[model samples]
Target: MLFDGDNDQKNKFIDHSMWNRLINDAKTPLTKGVHQFQVDLEEFLNIEKPNSKRGDLKPINVIKKHVSGEIAMDKLEELKAIVHGITSV
Candidate 1:
């Protein structure tokens, strides 16, 4: 019943596609350097629990385990490459 409304599925699909595009496109330096996994993890956590503090126990633990230590630029480039590979495939 979550997608009970008319066009809900379509809307969700579009929303996901837009999110993918935003995460994958590397035109902006800020966007290019962030890891997609990080972005996805954030999204997952946000949906699983809304309005939770970033440093809250659950979210903090999740981020601590998955967040990278690499420099931002390096992480961005890696994400760009991953997106490129996915698009090419």
Candidate 2:
């Protein structure tokens, strides 16, 4: 399983802060900005999936991995594009 330890290391990544704001911001309904949804999304990243590399498809983990330089440039670009699309809306 992909590991995100309990040290709050995500603070070291710029994208993590961006996502934290997006998820927690009172204006966005992306995940309703609610406590339960926040918890669920975090837990959801830990669930195993078939036919895919670990943490490859999870957006939450993607941000973490991308910011940590664990993922590819193309993947990062893809994520940026997606973010651009969302923020542009």
Candidate 3:
């Protein structure tokens, strides 16, 4: 027997696998904390969620209220460490 599939099938498979891996790996607090920080960063950048058209800048503006220069630098370092750890996996 022979089988055939389209690009969409392959893309979906890859996406599903990648998402599963990410979810499984996020069980650790270090990974979960970094992932949450990334989500917050996206919100602070006024990024619209998938399929959303509106961009709200209020969250971006509020960044300064919660983050200072020194704290920002420290967070940057933490982000880098998290990224490096993920990539090495």
Best by lDDT: 2
What lDDT is obtained when candidate 1 is compared to the true structure?
0.41
Summarize candidate 1's per-residue lDDT along 1-89 as a digit string, tens digits. 01111222236336654555544564454332333443344343333332455435644554454465322555456545666664542
Q: Answer with 2 or 3, whichever has the higher lDDT.
A: 2
Question: In model 2, where is the ten-residue run with the lowest total lDDT?
Answer: 31-40
Badly placed stretches (over 4 Å) of model 1 are 1-14, 29-32, 42-58, 63-89
Off by over 4 Å in 3: 1-39, 42-71
Report the C-alpha lDDT of model 2 over 1-89, residue by residue, as the tens digit: 12223332265434544554554454545532233123333343343333336545566664665467766666557545554554552
TM-score of each: 0.26, 0.29, 0.28
> How close to the true structure is residue 44 of candidate 1, measured as C-alpha lDDT?
30
lDDT of 3 by residue, 4-71 (tens): 11111236326544554455565655542333332345443343343234436534544553464423
Instruction: Return the candidate ranking by TM-score, descending.
Output: 2, 3, 1
After TM-score superposition, the amount by which residue 84's alpha carbon in candidate 2 deviates from its true location, in angstroms, is 0.4
Tell me, what's the RMSD of every candidate? 11.2, 12.5, 13.1
Model 2 stretches astray by more than 4 angstroms: 1-64
Give the Å shift of residue 44 in candidate 3: 9.3
Clash counts for the predictions, in order: 1, 0, 0
Residue 70 in model 1: shift from native, Å?
21
